[model samples]
Target chain A: MNESAPNPGDRIPPDELIDALFDGELSPRARREVLGAVRHDARAGADLERTARVLAALRAPPEAPDLTDRILHSADHRRRFVPGRLRRMTKLARAGVVVLALVVMLGVAAGRRAWPEATTLADEQTPLADVNEAFRDDAAAGVGAIRSSVHQVRMSFQAISTADPCVARLEIEAAPPHARMLTAGFVTNPFGIEDERADAPASIRCGAPRIGAGPTIWVGSNPLDPARPAAPDDTP
Target chain B: MLRSEEHKLIREAARGDQEAAASIIRHHQQSLYAYMLRMSGRPDVAEDIVQEAFVRVLTNLDRFDFRYRFSTWLFTIARRLYLNAIAKHRPAYDTDMVGSWKSSAASPEAPVEADEQQEARRDTLQAALLTLPPDQREVVILFHQHDWPIALIARHLDMPEGTVKSHLHRGRKRLRTHIEVAPSSGDALAESLA
Candidate 1:
């Protein structure tokens, strides 16, 4: 025996060394020393036996209850436990659908605002033929004929007279593309000849006598001023 | 189960395959249940922890890390749940009732005397384990019971391997003393007879 090796009778093995021996963690030399110490020491032998018994009992498999059905059933009842990827995908799909609906709705609203339906004053008011006939008859019958025969034309002039001048001007300016047809008819200067000039101030003339043979009325051109009877010289 | 096979099942389960989820549960539930049963020493608590752990794992299957073993992740989740359960209600273990369920399911092939002896030993072991500190008890159970390596237990418990080994050594020594002092059922029977 080497003098460097501690004699087993010198002292009992430490609990750590004994545990390491049982755990198979000790080197072969350490194992031999521990076993030699344990053999020489009855207390160490009993301690080893107790540890072996405890470890054996612990290693023995415990009866595991079969809980497969219960766990699966409980999991199902608690929630539709979809996996993360599928759940995220489902959420994305729902959000995509909502976004698509909003986009379509906004697109339709913008399209309606950008391109509206066509509406003309002729469509809403009296037919152009009737107005021309009334104008022609009134011109032939002179100033007295304007009150009786030109009923529609008188009503149109009265409407323009009572209405906001700016609103009436906007209506004329906003007329549909086909409004140029009105100027080509017998009622040649229905609103007044000077009113046709872009630079001319807005005005209305009601029952004013014509400059020559026709019963044309050339009212004054200042819209802000009150409507007055036209002087024959004002016909230009 | 093989690692490759387990990964395949995990993928299927994440895709919402009920059968795959069931297979995963069937493969792991018993060992997990045994672990919790030993840890809590209450059948009902064990059952509850096992069910809750599976529910949590299956619900968040996509978050699982593939590099680690599925069992490691599962046991980690179960350990957390057990700790939470303990914090909420520190159960007083009924040693007599600890393994009573096993008695009914005991194998017919085993001799009656040996089975009773085995049951007695298991009860004594569980009672002794309950006497240890939580960390020591966990190290002991994971090491001796589950046959986990010291390195794995160290990783699982988030401690150093040396600390884990220290706990295991101390836990085993304490368990031995507790078992030696506690009166076995056989001894009680002998005393009654005498």
Candidate 2:
């Protein structure tokens, strides 16, 4: 076969032909041709032998009983849940996203109600900063005189503009007198200015020299009312 | 080609028959498990991967394309699962095949010294197989161990026939080199090649 090697004319490379021999792709006649050549040629013989031994050495371990059982058990587990559980999980995820979106929307609405945009006080010429200082001074003076009776005061700030140097007013209301050092706190608008109006009841008895210490001071019951009626001598 | 009986079992298993499913698992589990064990070099991981592969195969049985061999499709699914496991960076299953080989050498059942010697030789061959690149290792394994034709391997791996041939040739050459330089009694394995 090697002596009269009919050059099949580049149709089949020797390496490819030999590889096909191992793969059993060649016909019986071709198989005999390659097997005979491999037997006679030293290099070709080594190639076939090496391939065979390496293949032999890679023997797989025998299958165990437990491994088969585990596989069957796992298949059973998937049969129980794969389709149904996937659809259910997808539905739960969509519901969760909708709930999160609604919570965010409600949060924005509640924030707007709690802190409205600023509104101007009667005297627009006084900067809100100066009004804040005056309110602080009044509270400080009243703090000593009313310390025995007044326990806590709620100060609300209303701003007329969102930017700095905007107009605003601080109205102070005191809770019934308590033991601690006034347990002081302040309320500021979203603009960070400490000013706004809130109605105090006459029963609570709020008193400061600048803010009227009378029943008419608490006449208007609506906390949301915009009318901040000034006193007889202090009318703006 | 699956015999008529095996084909019938496959059809029954696909139709939610539990007993047929068990029979199907019994038929294919050995070769599948062995292939995974040799590929990953970890018995524990091989077991896990084989189980997961079967789960996927059974759950999607309706999608099985009948033109191909069942083992080919099964191994293809198993290969993909193995690759995904590697991609996820799951911890390597301990390389305890060698450790077990050591303990098995002293087993009371193997009372003959030749049995111990054969175990040692088998352990060396296994170690060499594990050291080959995974691609080369798998081709050599499917070709040499499973007797899969090169064409079938190309189909299973979704690669060109030329590429599969290249891998097989390079893999055999490398395995020869690996076995030659292996740590234990290299002469014994080298003689096998000769």
Candidate 3:
């Protein structure tokens, strides 16, 4: 027996060769050779029988109880309503988040109103030129009342004059019933006014009139001529 | 089931057609149950895995990949569920119990001796299978029982084809030995009793 020559029995492992033969992996010639070898070898033949028996037994289908109704019932319940319910829950969660955000924003806005520092900062940021123009417009419209509530107007006046030499005077007195207020104010020339009057409380007077109170009056001098008294017809 | 027909049923099932889902379940339930039964060695666990696997598959039918066989997907889901179940509760390989369960439902027309022999062979085969490691058992069951080709088993088991052959070879050899030894041992016990 030459060591270099392939012995038919030693060419493959018995188990592998048997599996390959059964799996049809071997060519017809190799299969005939393996089959012949198994027929002659008792152990190989028994291995083949064992493999066949196991395969036969395993291949025999066990009786599987019908599970269609049970599975369908579970799937139906999940498909019909669980996903819809989850979607609804997701929508409700989104709505809740939106409502919560709105509440937070409203709360912050209300909190900003309650904080004097925030109110002052906001008022300081307002252009004095815009405020003067707004006052002039309100005065011209024969409505002394500023568009904003009275408290905001007071803070606006205090913030404006305290930060700049643009002196504005606003006065309010009782008006007819049902009207909130009658406001009269004037912007004075910064160049004509003496520097000392810039600090004078009388030059930038603002009345603390309650909102929605009885109608109040506002009177002011001509902005172009600080010395001229406000005409009686200017009072609304 | 034909692949085209299976795909059609899957499409309809994905759209929540209960009839289509039932068709799919009926086609697959038996083979899947048998696979689970062999893997877990418990009919109850097998039944639970089958029902749960079908429910999960039908519910997630949209996610199924069409390139693979539906049976592959179903078996994969069932295999995972079985692994999880076994992790929670280890299954027992009770030959007497399994034999009785199978034999009780044996074909009424078959002769009693033939049925007994068939039941004994099945019992011995199952007991021998349980003795092998999980990987070898799975490879053997997929190859021999389900008639899956070695390449498909490789893909399913996520291993090289050579490795699958190695497992199959080893598993078959062990099964042969256990099955061969079982009857002789029984014979020796009977001789002693006589």
Candidate 4:
């Protein structure tokens, strides 16, 4: 305690000092000093008393209804979407991928016909029609014995008459037995690579159609092609 | 200083332990509810905010830094939720209310209600508290109602000690002014203050 600390006999302390004392900010010596002053001075005593009264009344509210159950329930519900538990969804997605891949293999093995020798088309609007026409004609040739075990379908193209760099769009369509046609498209820089293969598992997994209709692919100019006039390359 | 066991409970609660979550709620619910009741001036609203705060606290436990008190983090989240609720729906602080819905902690004598005078005084103080700006009201509520130390309050509000002290001082000044002039056609003054 400070020797100079005021006694209870002293007058009321300043308001800031009283506030600090109430707030528990005063040091021990200062607190003792303020307490001593507040004890004897009637006004200071009332002020301190009033402040304490207010603080106590704040606690008078009855206990709130227990919320632990509700909170826990909400949390448990939300945990499903939390990233940490996303592995559950990942497991489901993986199962779906496996099923889709199986469907693709079955479809490719059961319905694939010996397609007419591969057709190469130049990047032109008219050749795009020719490409589609060629795919239809080949599918019309009818199905044959499926020999290959490997399920990869490779589409190779070498652009011959393009002035600027160009890309080719290849759409692989499979008509599964009773379901709608499933189609997947790929864009290729024909100048850079001779061919691009769309894996059976991935291209087939794009849609879950039945597994009976054979797969036919139509190769054309980049659908986003600006101007096209050259005839398609017809090499086998 | 909190017990080591309480910290353990926090860690366990963060790991999805239901018992730990219950313990944490039981430990802080009273103080938390009272604080919200004082801040929001409604028992229903206070309860809802507390429930919402607990959900947020439990869900975000991984992000909670152990450097600070758990109660501080809990209250910080509760405060933000209440503010957001207020922003969406400004609640009415009405008159002649009973139960736990008072903005300012009333003078203790209000409970006993020895006479009509004491009751009126309590009402006036509540009205005065409503007149305070939210910043000042929050400081006052945290300091007086919750017995929070100035330093802890500074940390909770992310403000300097001087600022917290300033808000407390101004808040107390306003309360004093309201209580002193509550009688004799002071409704206008109270409205202007609000």
Candidate 5:
């Protein structure tokens, strides 16, 4: 047969024909032509023989039973599990949102409850530069006492609610009354004329002393109806 | 009748029918596992893919269309699950099909060896198989290992015959030369995988 002319017995080189053969992708006539070549041509026969050996090695036995079970189980796990998964995901998302909202709410509550702790501009300019430090000291030393010598003695203060000044009249828990020159004032040392006025209770009863010790922390059953009823005063 | 039977069983299983679900499982598991083993070359990984496929099928039986053959639908499900598994754990997969992927991929205990002769042939074939893209690989495994024809592959893949032929052509071309060499020598594997 002529080398260039087509022959029923001549097979195309493998590189040229393998793609068409595997899928029968070639035109029917061309496939017939090529297949004729592959079967009859000695070179093509050699090529196919070599190729079949490779396919043979791939013929490993079926996979293990356990692996087969595992695949089915995995597929089953995916199929059977959806509702529970959706329910779980939804629950987790809701729980997360709830936790986030709760955190925000807690932050707002704390902000409002601790309002008094916010230091005013005047306090910033004054000695109580560290307001939190002062409140902490006050809590530990004693409530409402300005000086308790509880080691590092300190004071704390907030605005006196009313513009008009008021007195603090609580029974002093005197650690030692002998050396106790307890001068209770509003720390208003610049205005010297009313040191004693500042020392007295701004809202005292008619005949109550200027400054004396009594149990300010109300303890008795009728502490309000004191041991003796005092007359009223128009100090307001 | 087969479709209706599978449909009935699937319907029952969706309604929490364990026996029916297991019946579905028992029917398709082996074939699905074998296909995955060839497609992925990791019996253990293929095992996981099969299970995941069935699980998805059962969970979504309500969405299953009865017009198609149940086995066809099952293979589609299996194919999707396998693809998903490939995606989820990407880096470790041997793209070139070297690194003992076929054997190590299974139980991690499948006996492997240094025998250049036996293992070399297997490695050469695997490496060539991996060269084709994933779709081509799917078609090849379904066609050769399972002996499913082009029409069935087309139905399961939802692709046209021409496209399936193209993939198979491309896949076979990629593999044909490598297979021809026999890999009796180590250098052949080195060159093929490389």
Candidate 6:
């Protein structure tokens, strides 16, 4: 490097002076004299030249920020706002959806309340009659309805073991002239002879229970059908 | 003069204005970014470092002393960040890399065009400087770039003036060898030596 250059900031010479030389930091008189020697001195000349070039380049700007582009990409926003009115709109929409859902659920609840008795008629009655009925009674009161006609019908029986096989509570419902009927009685298609002879009662007929302040109406039955069906007696 | 108004904005920001905080970034970003990029030799890394430094400065604006120039303070922050980055990404410099740089690839007399061309010149210099040992490169840059008195360079670097000189002499000598052999770098090197 700069061999024997006053041993660089020492008692031998001021450290600051040598540093000044390296940085071209000297005042005019000193700079001229120091530079003169360096020029004459082959080694010092080359040293100063390279030193100057490096310095000049360093003084130039470093790569200008490509950061703006990258920061925007990373943060996913070119600009940030105050989170103002848009936030209010989002909250309003979410509240509206929740309210709509609640209203629909409430409507369904009201409908179920109005028609309570009709909802569960299927479960209380086990296998109902497979009646071969050719009768239609358009009655004012009904709980639930499933009607099918057969020429000959058979219903396998599971007797209660103690009660009469022919007896069940019968509910006959009609319009204003008659109030609803709630009665317990015996029903017999006796003899187990596999007959469809009694079409007069129009197969196994039923109606709603008695009307009351409480909201409910249903009919109950004990099943009795033979294993098979034979010809109807009313055919003639 | 005020590092382009960031110090003023920082004061306003510290006084509880959120908008002031934004103003500080806008004002100081370009110059600070330029400084960091020159200091750190990687363009991509330099970008990240500058943004982070600005954010940090904004957050800690209250801690700044009133006496010092804001650019000096900002630069000190930039330098510290640059050093930390160098440590984290401490690359093993293969000596072969020093060969390709070969001083000035662009002719000193080449017609200057875009501002980016000037930037490329600095980046090239930064790359070459990184080829030097850290001690020599720092002294060399401080000396030539600032042309500061040795006392200032010494204070700035926190090294003794003697050490600054040693680094200067040795760094300049090493650089001279490359420049003499460098193509198109003729006059700048010649003028410096003269």
Judge candidate 2 at residue A92 and give its lDDT. Answer: 92
Which of the predicted structures, 1 or 6, would earn the higher DockQ when compared with the native?
Answer: 1
lDDT (C-alpha) at residue A161 in model 4: 28
Residue-level lDDT of model 3, residues B38-128, one tens digit each, is 8766677788999999999988999999999999999989988888876776634333435434544567898887676655555666677
Which pairs clash (backbone N, Cα, C closer than 3 Å) in model 1?
A210-A216
Q: Write the per-residue lDDT of candidate 5 for residues A1-236, one digit (tens) a residue.
A: 11222356643545546554554456766666666777767766655555544444444545446443453455455554345456557669999999999999998778767774562233344556578688898797674354444321121121222211222212222223421234234323312333334333323321232233332322222223444334333121
True contacts kept of each: 0.54, 0.51, 0.68, 0.33, 0.21, 0.28
Per-residue CA lDDT of candidate 4, range B93-163, in tens? 34333334433334456654333433344455556666788888888888877778889999888899999
Give the alpha carbon lDDT tens digit for every residue of B49-162 in model 5. 776677667777788777766777777878777777778866555453365454432444554554443456555666666767888888877776677889998877889988
Q: After superposition, how far is residue A149 of candidate 4 from its true place, in Å?
A: 51
- Superposition TM-score, candidate 2 onto the true structure: 0.52
TM-score of chain A of each: 0.31, 0.25, 0.30, 0.30, 0.25, 0.24
DockQ winner among the candidates?
Answer: 3
Off by over 4 Å in 2: A1-20, A25-50, A59-66, A80-236, B1-3, B90-108, B190-194
Better of 1 and 5 by lDDT: 1
How well does each candidate superpose onto the true structure, as a TM-score?
A: 0.57, 0.52, 0.58, 0.52, 0.47, 0.45
Q: Show the colliding residue pairs in model 6.
A: A9-A15, A166-A187, A167-A186
Q: Give the clashing pairs for model 3.
A: A144-A183, A173-A217, A175-A215, A182-A216, A182-A217, A182-A218, A183-A218, A184-A218, A184-A219
**Local accuracy of candidate 6 as per-residue lDDT tens digits, B87-123:** 7766622222323322232456766553335434443
lDDT measured at residue A127 in model 4 versus the true structure, 0 to 100: 75
TM-score of 5: 0.47
Evaluated on CA atoms against the true complex, candidate 3 attains a DockQ of: 0.37
How many residue-pair clashes does candidate 4 contain? 5
Ranking by TM-score: 3, 1, 2, 4, 5, 6
The TM-score, computed over Cα atoms with residue i paired to residue i, of candidate 6 is 0.45
lDDT of 6 at B92: 27
Q: What is each candidate's DockQ, to 2 decimals?
A: 0.35, 0.27, 0.37, 0.18, 0.14, 0.17
C-alpha-based local distance difference test score of model 6 = 0.50
Candidate 6's residue-wise lDDT over A126-223, tens digit each? 33332212122333123222111110111112221232232221211111112211111222332232334444241232211123424322223211
After superposition, candidate 3 runs with Cα above 4 Å error: A1-13, A81-236, B91-104, B107-114, B184-194
